[model samples]
Target chain A: MITLTHVHKSFGDNHVLRGVSLHVPKGQSMVIIGGSGTGKSVTIKSVLGLVEPDSGRIEVDGREVHEGDRDAFLARFGMLFQGGALFDSLPVWQNVAFRLLRGALKRPKEEAREIAIDKLRRVGLRAAVADLFPSELSGGMQKRVGLARAIAADPEIIFFDEPTTGLDPIMAGVINELIREIVTEMGATTMTITHDMTSVRTIADRVAMLHDGVIQWEGPISEMDGADDPYLAQFIRGRADGPIEAVR
Target chain B: MSGLLSPVAALGRSMLALLAYVGRVAIFAGATVAHVFRPPWYWREFGWALMQIGWLSLPVVGMTALFTGGALALQIYDGGARFQAEFAVPSIVAIGMVRELGPVLGGLMVAARVASSIAAEIGTMKVTEQIDALVTLSTHPMKYLTVPRVVAATLAVPVLVAVGDSIGILGGYLVGVTRLDFNAAAYLKNTFDFLELWDVTSGLIKGAVFGFIVALCGCYFGMNSGRGAQGVGRATKSAVVTASVLIFAANYILTEVFFAA
Candidate 1:
């Protein structure tokens, strides 16, 4: 389980996250929907300590996120970045098995490779795709590779940052389905950030709409549609004029 | 009065900004050095860096040294001719190449090639969020990226300078014996005789220092790069420019320390 309390982050004049507090219970899929530059990425990054928050408390399993050993802390979680963020220098399998090839989670080369191929298969990728570089793969294939890597280590918590942003509708649907199926099968706690309403419908068990650096509304997916909040309604309906302005 | 004061204020601001930039680079270099001695050393990354920063730079460094040495030989022979000291050509060429030209030119060449490549590569990685991915994967980006490169360049560029020195002397020898019509054996003897152990060693030491500067500039500019393709382009340009300028400045200070009376 993960919890963020009163998280506030600002970049010079831009106040991104202002008193953002949220929780994702153990093994639940918490999808955060927000417009561009609403600090959705920064919120997750703050929890991961990639971006230091100006004022906040982030905890996993009731322990401070920044406390104790960093390597151990990070080992509990995996991330699938918006761009896939696969290392171009490495082959696909190496990227998938990166954590396994080095540091605390290190395994033998053959064993790591085997696991990478297995994860690739789980993501519907062929074993032969393992040796090719990330650039060699198609956009959908790259996203699949990123997904494979995120789940490769079988982490307790997984963060998907805009998982289907750049893919075509069909490919996006495939990724959304894969994410939904995988999250259910693994029973891992997940926090996904995206503006894709379709993805939210498909993957979210619980939904939270983030706006103006705060959680405007949050509840079960079923409640999201009929929520009385105008901001939530405008966002869900893709309206340009509403309580939430179209442009910032 | 306000107009006159504005220039002074601008100068003060520029000075402060320059100081801040230097302080940041110093901190980055210090952290990189600290990571070098820590455990979980990424030998694979270090080895790869060594190959890229060292082995791959040979062709450009060699060509630069060879041409410069040949040109130095010709100039020395022509100038010495007026002073009735044409015999100084071989010794001067050898001493100049080994002492100053070898490491400085080699370092500059590596800076242009390796520094630009490193800055672009790391800057792109930063933009793509691969750096954050490294962090989430339980790896320190500094350990995984900067330490290997800085250490590899520090250890490898001296060897490159040494190789460049020899090739450069060979270039001079070819010119002296054939073009300048000097006896081949005599030219070789004079080159060997004029070169001191300290001269070659001093250049190698400069090579190590220059190597450190080049890689540090690349990594520093890269890790601190702003976002997007334009940001990466700026980082690459800054890396090469900073590495080159620092190499020249370091070379001068080192020369003063080693050879000044």
Candidate 2:
């Protein structure tokens, strides 16, 4: 279970997250949907402790996220960045197995490579693609590699940032399906940040719509459709005119 | 009155910013040094950095030292001829190359090549979120990235300085015997007699210090670089400029401490 209580963050004069508070029960897929630059990434990063919140508390499993044994805390979570964030200097297999190559979770090189190849296969990548660099892969393949890397260590919690942003319709559908299967099969707790409405339909167990740094509407996906809140209606209908500024 | 006060305010701000930069760089350098002595060390990254920073930079530093030595010998011989003192060419050339020109020029060249590159590579990584990825992967970016580079530069530059000094002395020797019409045996004897152990040691020490400055500036600007292409470019340029200036400043300070009467 994860919860963010009155989390406030600001960069210079721009207040991105004013007072965001949300909760997701254990082993549930909670997807946060908001317009671009609305602190969606910052919200997830706060939980991961990548971006420090200006004020508020984020707790995972009733323990403060930033307290006691940082490495061990990070080890329990996996994140798939919007840009894939694969290391250019390393081959795909090495990038996927990066956590296993060094530091506390280090494994034997051969075993790490084997596990990397297996994860790659799970993400629909062939074994031979392991030797190539990230630049050599297509956008879809890179996202798959990023997904493979996020799940490489079999972390308890996985966060996905814009999993479908740059992908084609078919590729996006495939990624959504992969996310669904992984969540159901592993029974892992997940928090996905995305603007793609279709990904929300496929992957979310419960959906929370964030606006102006606060949760405006939250319910099971079945209830999201019937919700009468004007903000959620405006967003779900893809209207340019809404409480959320379109220009932002 | 307003115009005069505005400039004063601007000057104050600039001074404050410079002090802030100095403080940040000092702290970064301290963290990098602390990481070097701690465990979970990365040998492979350190080895690669040694090759990239030290071994790959040999040709440029060597060429700069060599040509400067030759030019110094020519200038000394010509200038000494005005007073009918051409015999001073070999000794003065050797001393100039070993004492001042060798480490300073070599440091500048490495700063241009190595510091700019380190900044660009690391700044790009920051933009693409690879640095955050490193953090989420449970690895400290300072340890994983900065330590190896600083250590490599610190160790490699002294060796580079030593080699550059030898080649520069050789350059002066070649020009002295052939172009200046000085006897080869006499030129060799004069060079050996005039150059002291302290002169070469001071240059090598300066080289090590310059290397530290280059690595520190590169890593500091890189880790603190803003986002996007412009940010990366700005960081690269800043790293080279700061490294070169610091090297020159350090050179002057070291000379005063080591040789001033």
- Residue-wise C-alpha lDDT for candidate 1, range B1-261, written one tens digit per residue: 999899999999999999999999999999999998998899999999999999999999999989998999999999999989999998898889888999999999999999999999999999999999999999999999999999999999999999999999989988888799999999998888887999999999999999999999999989988999999999999999999999999999999999999
Kindly list the per-residue Cα lDDT of model 2 for residues B40-96, writing each as its tens digit.
Answer: 788999999999999999999999988888888899988998999899888888788
Off by over 4 Å in 1: none
DockQ of each model against the real complex?
Answer: 0.95, 0.91
TM-score to native of every candidate shown: 0.99, 0.97
Give candidate 2's whole-model lDDT. Answer: 0.92
Residue B89's lDDT in candidate 2: 85
C-alpha RMSD for every candidate: 1.0, 1.4
Per-candidate iRMSD = 0.5, 0.7
What's the distance in Å from true for residue A90, model 1?
0.8
lDDT per residue (tens digit) for residues A151-205 in model 1: 9999999999999999999999999999999999999999999999999999999
**Candidate models: Cα lDDT each:** 0.94, 0.92
